[model samples]
Target: MVLSVHEKVKSERLYKAFDLMAAKDLDAAETELHAGLSDAEAQEDKVLAALFYSSLGVLYKIKKEFPKAWKFYEKAEKLLPEDPALKLISARLLIDVFGQFDTAIRRCQKVLEISRSDPPFLHQANVTMGLALLKKGERTKAVSCLVDAMQDDFEGLLSASNIDLKLVEALLRKRSGLEECRAYLEKALRFAESKQEERHVELFRRLIEAFPTEEATDVKIQM
Candidate 1:
């Protein structure tokens, strides 16, 4: 009975810490989560303990303390190896903060192997992999991965407005001087049905415009 009561208290504290973090009260969140971790340790709750470390990692990442972030993330991963979300997040943080692109790509690949049907995680994994690949000058592989992810159902992504595959393709095209993919820009524009879609489409339009205009508009038109 005492142990259960203690666990409940720790759980509540952990949630409160998470709320504080969401509210951007980093200091308060850290205090509360650390307190929860202390209680969880006393109760020998491995799962809750892992959650605490993962929560701290997120906080540290937000604070731009990458080393501290990964420290806790590693602990959490050791405790919960099956958590694809945590693994994905850790890989992203590593890529973003430490420029460990190769490691990030490898981690994301592992996520892809296990998360074939999980759209959201798969999207994250692919995005991270694409960005990492881009950093390594592997533009073709990057675009292939990113395009596959963008072609997936948007309902699984965080913001339907944010998946700008056309921009990535444009970037790759411009770097490689590949004018053949200009049709993809038009297709992306056609796909833009909503206001958010239109905004992203406009961005892609600008990118395509930046690409050197071959001949003139009259050449393509049959007036």
Candidate 2:
């Protein structure tokens, strides 16, 4: 496809934003990303615009502005109807930004239906689907999704939020399999504690404190 003047401008601005991110100047990155979004809209570059929105959502998430992140993610999802890449990225950002587990699940489900064993984004879709299901308390379903994601052999795809296959294992182990879960959570707790990610550490701690060991086994998912 031929690139329009506005699209070119937007693309350049987007590049600048990524450069800023690479330099660890998050604020500057956000400024450049916003500029790119503006140009993309002006040019009516729907695909590029959707991508920029998703990028904005990720930036906002790193900045801890969850609501703002969700706003941009929703925009991306709305704008990118024809592109599976755009849809999948938007969906993953929805989970990272808003913690809207159900919405993330739905998006992952849609991608599973459409993705034809492609590279890159297909792997991402699997990881996002797994995490979404996990967050929604669907232990069995979550394990299935994540296990499917693991088929891609991509590790860094979903590492930004300290969630990965290990986290999934810990969560499932704690709920479904007693000895296995305890061991997993203990390992996860060590990692979280060492990283000083107190919030995450507290989450695991709460599981230990709130429920009896026997009760942890055979726990039904709420959602």
Candidate 3:
């Protein structure tokens, strides 16, 4: 279906706002989004309003304004509750920023149920769920989810965050499984080498050195 003139204007403004964000001009991006959001609100366009709200949420996240980000994200989700991306970001922000571990886990559970066929979404939901479970003091289950995420979709895990680094750090902090940690870094090292992510390769190398396996072979993943 063809977009009306107002819709086309809104779309153009959205693209322009992102262009500003890509250039790291976050203040300008915020201004652009605010303007677009006013138009969406004036028009009573829930879809466009949700889009603007979500974009504002991301902007605030980049600005490290977690409270404001969550506020906007909630607004977006209220308008489009079934959107998986909104739920995922809500889970992430809850876990990483808001310290609401149980809430994040519940959001991730919904994602897991709804996103079973979407591998990328599933990978991130699993990993994030594992993190939330870990924070909630379920060590055994957390490790199981983390390892499963890595084993099932290493590439997909990488697509979202610094997967290996986060996993290794969590294990190290917990002092849970040195063998598993070492193997994780080893796999990450290989991926970094392949991708030519030199800094990550070096970081993984250093982390692997700390583990120091005597066997000089691949450590078996227990999960």
Best by lDDT: 3
For model 2, the local distance difference test gives 0.61
Q: After superposition, how far is residue 219 of candidate 2 from its true place, in Å?
A: 23
For candidate 1, the C-alpha RMSD (Å) to the true structure equals 11.2
True-structure lDDT of candidate 1 = 0.63
Please identify which of the two predictions, 1 or 3, would achieve the higher TM-score against the true structure. 3
Q: Which digits, one per residue and each the tens of the lDDT, describe model 1 over residues 67-100?
A: 9989987887788777566466556545554566
User: What are the C-alpha RMSDs, in order, of all predicted structures?
Assistant: 11.2, 12.7, 10.2
Q: Could you tell me the C-alpha RMSD of candidate 3 in Å?
A: 10.2
Residue ranges of candidate 2 with Cα displaced over 4 Å: 1-36, 42-45, 51-79, 151-223
* Rank list by lDDT: 3, 1, 2
What local distance difference test score does each model get?
A: 0.63, 0.61, 0.69
Better candidate by lDDT, 2 or 3: 3
lDDT of 2 by residue, 135-187 (tens): 77777765565556545333333222233434344455456434444444455
lDDT of 3 by residue, 23-103 (tens): 899999999999999988998977778878977887898899999999997898899787566566656656664567887
Cα TM-score per model: 0.51, 0.44, 0.56
